[model samples]
Target: MLILSRLRAYLRAVYCRQSFFPGPLGVFVNPFYLARSALQEAMRDSAETLNGRLLDVGCGTKPYRNLFHVSEYVGLDIDSPPARARGVADVFYAGKAFPFDPASFDAVLCNQVLEHVFNPDEFLAEIERVLKPGGKLLLTVPFAWDEHEQPWDYARYSSFGLKALLEKQGFRILNHRKLRADVSVLFQLANAYLYKLTERWPFSARLLFNATVMALFTLMGLLGARFLPDNPDLYLDHVLLAEKSA
Candidate 1:
């Protein structure tokens, strides 16, 4: 067991450190992703409650590796990773059909990856095929945003839509949350837009605008989460934890 573990570790190191990966999410991860994540971590079921072999699909840069305390982790992506993708992935591959045996994983994490698939339904079905019976899937998808990474970009889904789709694939949602709303959404759009304006507006004006918008949104989350009738459904990121039906 120790020898095989070392061998897998060596192979993972060589594979992840290679060139051609999308660098770090810090570069391509979409800036607004942070604010949404803050809300998500605050909202629900984030801690790794399930312990078994795990897989993270389209795990660009692999930011959530630490959240799970699983026995093993595998991160698969279309390209090689920027740095060593943290957490633990035995191997990183180059396609949607993940290379694994049937029911090989206890859980799958597919964050911000589905929209980029050519056929998300088929891709998700593939996710279903790889999970052990009663294993879980943790996924996050976008609902609003311009098409930037097209060719790779596919479609967004509503909460009900995704839930129904997963049920059809033989999974049951344990918990779901849609994060980032109203001012938070506004700040995200403004931040992205104002970044472009840095070239247009003066440096001071741009910085002031960006800071003020961010502050407002941050305050909105604090104040609104109690009194603002905050609705996760009409938000930026939809996160779900679903179990493969028995």
Candidate 2:
């Protein structure tokens, strides 16, 4: 029991640091590796264009902080128990509005947060208000994901739907991408479903079971991705880069 607990803690520590871009062992142990790895690739590709006084909305642990080349990075989230426990937020705000002045930031990064926003219009408006003209907004939202973050999870958006939503908020879309547009998405979902079924098992048994399942599924997913036709229309998430018109 003690050994299993220690092992779990060690793996968790590794997961915290290498979440989106997991290490080799993490490839087998992490159930969401396929989805998260694709997200990391998209973010890394988009990180270079963002610079100076950047704001990270819903910055849970500022996981990708080192990826961006910016003069200043400020983390913001709602005042909640999870946010406090993470100890990453530089500023906390009520759900309605941000605490900063208008046109305060040169760039804004809101990753995997849009689905959780109850008032997306007001949320995007706040982002636009806080960002300087011509500043970039790098946003990622889930398109085909299970409900997460509990009761806070509200919606999912298709590629076109997301584009329309951002454009409605006066953000000019620069680049839009569909992530995990491969058979890997199917395998990932299967692995996740199985993982949930074993939730009641002992920690050691569950861990072993998940690791085996993940490994097998990941291998199959990779092979399918190599051989199958890609389906961009059916993907896991959408990553977009938009600019506030100058």
TM-score against native, each model: 0.71, 0.94
- For candidate 2, write residues 144-218 as lDDT tens digits: 888887998999988778778888988999999998798988998887787678869876676587578777887
In model 2, where do residues sit more than 4 Å from their true spots?
1-8
lDDT of all predictions: 0.66, 0.87
Give the alpha carbon lDDT tens digit for every residue of 5-90 in model 1: 88767744533332122122222223344454453473235646567888888776666676678898777766445424453445
Residue 210 lDDT in candidate 2: 54
Model 2 residue 176 CA deviation (Å) reads 0.8
| Predicted model with the maximum TM-score | 2
Where is the poorest 10-residue window by lDDT in model 2?
A: 14-23
After TM-score superposition, what is the CA distance of residue 116 in candidate 1 from its true location, in Å? Answer: 0.6
